[model samples]
Structure formats: structure tokens, C-alpha cells
Target: MRTGKPSKTAIKVSSSIVTLGTTSYGQQILPDGLVDASEKILLASGVVSEKGVRWIKSPRMVSVYRAFDWLLPGQFEALGERKAFFERQVRAGIAAGATQILVLGAGFDTLGWRLATEFPKVKFFEIDHPVTANVKAKAVSKLGRRGNLYLIAEELGKRKLPDVLATHGSWNRESRSVILAEGLLMYLPAQAVRELFGQCLAIAGAESRVVFSYIPAGPDGRLDAGRWTGLMLWLQKVAGEPWLWSIEPQNIRSFLEGIGWKIAPELEGGTGRHSTEYFAVATNQA
Candidate 1:
């Protein structure tokens, strides 16, 4: 489990890698090339010899990754759906004249690398913990600096993101940017989630947009996400990261509106109906 410092949080990192692996190798979520490159890089990392990256793309790991789906079927299906939502947001950002692209909690994903090439003028920020950022930097270094990828290494719990950006980021509060927080919000408490939105508002212009995925939890704060099963307990024990906050899809509008964002859209899987998990793209209206 390649994870966090002073404790074992790398397992969560590997969990993200597993998602990339299964999707990269199995579902062909991305028909184009390089979709699986990051997973390939992780497999070739030093941790493979140290057994840091495992249970992904292999039968056993794929089975465990799929087990949560059995309890709440089509959750895996939803992950596939999320890939499209992210791309749409990025395209919209580029069309909207975004100066920078911020990928918050960017694990081992390669979206930044691809986006940098596709949009040469836009600077891409891949923000993550120092450990994950370090490993990703090394592996990506072998690929030879794709474009203007600025790596900002910092732990979110240790500091507010805008402050970290002030120290390490090239863009600023006035910069028109698009933010992606895929698979990140669920780990934060509601207060922290509120703080995240507040920070987004502080930095964003009226045109700034954010796209993210969330797990809808019941009133007790347990995962009843969109009529899906709640396997959060198993995740807390296995991955060491638990689902902490949730909101119903319909309420997402009010939630963002209360925070000064205009509702963009909530997209679903190719199946039409939203999967167990859903994605929302909200723009800063103020």
C-alpha cells in the first residue's frame, strides 16, 4: 500500500491507481491511446518490486474492486460515466477561455498531460500530496515533460489550497480557471466541503467552472448514494479513506446556489440514467 506519510495512506493512492487500471485495461473507457499510460507508469514504478502496487488489473484485485459493485451494482458503471463528464468540463473550460486548469487531488491520472498538449497555451496544475506527486513526477519525467505541467505538492489537510497556490501556483485568484475534483469531496466533512467551495469562490472569476463527483449519503451520513449500496465501512477498513459527506442530486443546485454558483448540469452514464454515483458541473456566477 503506497500511501500517506507517518501512517498508511498510500493504499488510497493505490486504490485510485486500481480504478485507472481497471478502466484503462478492462473497460476501454478511453478508446484513444495514453489512457492507460499512467497505470503503466505505476506498474513500472519501484513500488512494484516492493509490492506497493498490486491487486489491480489482475484477477484478484479486479474482483475486490468489483465486489463493491455487487453490493451496489453499476457503481463501476458510474465510474465509466465519470470519464465523459470530466472531459466535457475540460472542453468547456477551454472553450470558455480558461487560463489554467487545476486538478485537485490528482492521484496518478494523466488528464493533465493530455490536456497540456491539446491546449498548448493553458497551464495545467496537478495538485496532490508530496508522496504521490513525487512518484508521478519521476515517472512522468521519463515521458519527458509533455507541456506546461506545473506540479504543486501539498497535503490538503495541512493547508488551505489557495494559500498553497499562492506559494507554489503560477496562476492566481484573478485567473480564469477550471477546477476538477474528481473523487475528492467524499473524503471531506461537510464543513471542509463548505470551505472548499468558499475557497473556490475566493479564487474564481464569474466564468470559472468546477466539475466533481460525489457519493450521496443518507441523513445519518452513511452512504445511501443515489439508491446505491453503502460499502463505505468496507472502504474505511480496507482503503483507510471513508466517505464523510453527501447530498442528494436534486439538492446539489441549492447547495451550490447557496454558495454563489450557477447550476451547469448533472450528467449520467451512457446508459442514460445516472449511475450510483453522479457528476455535477457548477460555475461561479458571482
Candidate 2:
């Protein structure tokens, strides 16, 4: 992300969602409705021709992506699992009496769209960089707008979250909400991360919760994953969005408490031999 350019990683994630939704492995991990919504967005974005959409479903392209997975190792599975995991958290929040869904750095994810349709009474708001948000806005417009779903375009790290969200008339700060920051925190600096959480808390009503993902530091307090660490960092740097922040798994509790949140009981694994990523659920009891 340059100031005006769309996030390359966002486009890549959209493409991966389509591939996974179309493939068997993805079918296993993702909800049927979510895959369907993603497929609709893929076509609506006009990134590919209607004929090219058919081509995307071809076994050849899927195999090509599978080969890339071999190079990246567990990335494909991780993405699918991550999406499914987030959906479960969102559903849990809704069931727990949340009336609002606020997604930060929403990228091209179809979670909000699909959930908006599923839970018509609950409002859904997705905020992203103007460039990427515009792309999604165009696609979403073609899908027929849901009155409850608000697509907001703002530069998250540059602007204060509270100010950006406050400008949106449809956003209800007094409502109980589930704030999602999937694949976003690592791209921000440590201070920005703190401010984001603080602002989310400020805007949310009591008991509002957050679900976010991050790449945790290894035991040595570095974002090292053996042979893949350098390559991963290089790939993100090449895309102009390098990973800049990470928290040790053990320290996550204190970190969130410092920001007016309490970590959920189930703390996902940190950077270890088994996994490099971590997902967290924290509640804003205040």
C-alpha cells in the first residue's frame, strides 16, 4: 500500500478465496454461502471476464495454485482455516447479542456481505483503504446494496479509527459490536496497533468483542520461522506492505488488558515449530 494504490495482498487474497471456494479443500473449510458470496464478488469486480471466470474454475489453474502452495507450505490451508475460524467467531458474537459487525482493513473478504444477508437485523460495516475499498464498493454495488451493510473507505493507519468511523452516519457507537481485524495488525506499527484497539474500545459498547489475527514472534522474541521467515518478509516488502508488529503469545493478555480488553480463554498457538500465525478473541468488558 502506497497512498493511492490498492493493496496487492488484498487482490491476491480475493483470488485465493475464489480458488479455495471452487476447490474441494476449500469447500471443506469454508461455509457454502461464503464461497458463493465470494464467487459473486469475483465476477462483480470485473477483474475477469465471464468466460475467464469459467477459466478460473479449471483444474489447471487450481493445480497451479496448489503448486504455489507447495512453495509456500501450509499457506493455502492456513488461509482457508483462518477464514472459517473468523466466521465462527463472528457467528458466536452475533449469538452472544452483538448488534453490529465492524471489520477493520476488511480487504476483499465476503464475510460481511454474506453475514449481512444471513443476519439482516445486524448492521455490518467494513472499513478499508480508499483504493481497496473502492474496488470492493464497485463489486458490492453490482450485487445490490444491503441497507445494513456499510462500506467505508479510509486509510486506517493514517487516520484515527474513531474519527473515520464517526463520520459515517450509519455507524452506531452505542451498539454492541464484534470488531474484526483479520490479517491487519501485523501490517501496522506497534503504536498504531495500540491506538486501533483503544479506538475500537472507545467506539464499542460494553461487552463488545474483537477477533484478530497476527504473526507471533518466536521464542527468541523475533518474527523468525526458520527458512521461511526471510522469504515471507521479502514477499510482503516486495508488495510494499511489510510485517511490522507482533506480540508474544504469553504477553497478549497483559497487552490487551493495558488497552481495556481481556483475552478469551482459547488462545491460539504462537510462532512455534507447528505454527507461525496466531488468532485472538478479546472482549471489551469496559
Candidate 3:
């Protein structure tokens, strides 16, 4: 397993990898080390057993399992869906003769490496925390696979993403760029979410696309997100990431519109009809 001072929140979420391995689907999508790291974190945090084979199952657990089942082999079907969405945008950009991709909260995700291999002409920028980024960099380096990959380590909210892109000489206004922020928005406060979207807008033009996932606020616009919300709160408490923010699905659209973003239709998945996870594409129209 990779060695680093991962935050308690990160460690807790990593445990999901272990839980993922128990399912046949999770093993197919996530790398062995990532799975191991997640299991190890869960064990260290006392969220799972020492052997890392079993998980503290709950409604949330069952729902996650169902989601993985829906996506198949890759314990992260949501990721695959998001990847497909990004790929479509990329293909559109290619058709329009555009190049360049930015992935926020790159984490231990393998999309960049996979996309690089698939589209050698495209350049990828992966932004993440220093510790997490180092872990990913080392893993990819050991694999001996290269793809015009640049890793930038910085706190996602505190730093200026546009400035970072400019410093790297990768910022291009003419190119069609796609930004991915998967499994990230739910963890941030409402204000920070707006700020991050604002930064993305500054870097992107009218033609650029931003795809992200978020946990929708229930009818009340509060954290009482029903079955899944309870599970997340329990998981967060165990993972030491008690701070979570959620917004009503409708309010999210309004907020995006307020930010001058033109949103596409919301994509929903999961077993619970009410507990719909959303995938929205926002175009920087302004």
C-alpha cells in the first residue's frame, strides 16, 4: 500500500475500495492497490474488520452495492458514467477541433491514464492534494505509462485554478475543454461549491463543458436526505468527516443558472427512486 498522511476523510472513503473488492464488480474497476489502500484505511479507522474482507453493511451499503451492480465489474459505475459523459464531450471537442482536459480531485482515479492511452493527442491536467497526488504519481510512474500528464498539488478550494492552469501554460481559450468533478461537490460547503464553479467558469469559455456529481437535497433542502443521508452521516462520523453539505436538486439548477451556467438535463441513478444522484453538464455561456 502507498504511504502518506491521508486525511481521516480520505482514509474513510478509501475503505469503500475494500468493500468494493468484496463485490465482483468493484474488483474489475478499481486497481488492486487502491482497493487494498481503501481496505487498509477502513481497518485502521476501525470501520471494517482487520482482514478487510467484510464491510459494516447498511441501507447505504446495499444501495452502493446495487449501484456497482448496475454499472458492473467496475465497482464505480458512477465513475464510468461520468467518464462516458466526459468522453462524449471530448469527442465533441475533437469533432470541433479542440484539445485539453482538466480533472479536479483526481484522487486515485485511473481515467487520466486510460484517456491518455486512448487519445494520445490530448493533454491531461490532474489537480489534487499534495499527498494524494504524490501517491497517484508514484503509482502511474511505476506502471511505466506516460501521457502528457501533469500533476498539480494544491488545496482545491484555497488556490486559484485558473492561475495554476496559466502557470502550467496549459490554459487555452480556443480549445474545447472539459472539466470533471466527480464525487466531490457533496463534501464541500455551499459557498465553496459556488466558488469552485466560479473558478471553473473563469478558465472555461462558452464552448467549454463542466460535468460533476452531487447528492441532491431532499424536498426540504436540508441534510435529511432519507436512507442514503443517514448512511452518509454514519459513514462520515466513522470516517471523521462530519461536515457535509447538500442542496435541493432544483436549487442546484437555479444556483448554476445564477452563476451564468447553462445546465443540461440531470442524470439520475441508484436503487432508491427518491435518492437520485445527479450528473449535470454546465456550459459557461457568459
Q: What is the C-alpha local distance difference test score of each model?
A: 0.67, 0.80, 0.62
Clashes within 3 Å, all models in order = 5, 0, 3
Worst 10 residues of 3 by lDDT: 266-275
Worst 10 residues of 1 by lDDT: 5-14
Ranking by lDDT: 2, 1, 3
- The digit string of per-residue lDDT tens for model 3 on 153-216 reads 7777777788788887866756677788866777677888888888888887567777776766
lDDT of 1 at 257: 89
Worst ten in a row by lDDT for model 2: 267-276
Measured by TM-score, how close is model 3 to the native structure?
Answer: 0.71
- Residues 106-206 of candidate 2: C-alpha lDDT, one tens digit per residue: 88889888888889999999999888889789999999888889999888877777788788877788899999998899899899999999999889988
Q: Model 1, stretches more than 4 Å misplaced?
A: 1-28, 47-68, 219-221, 225-231, 266-274
Top-scoring candidate (lDDT) = 2
lDDT of 1 by residue, 217-244 (tens): 5666456754424454555547656667
In terms of TM-score, which candidate is strongest?
2
Query: Model 3: number of clashes?
Result: 3
Q: What C-alpha lDDT, on a 0 to 100 scale, does residue 13 get in candidate 2?
A: 68
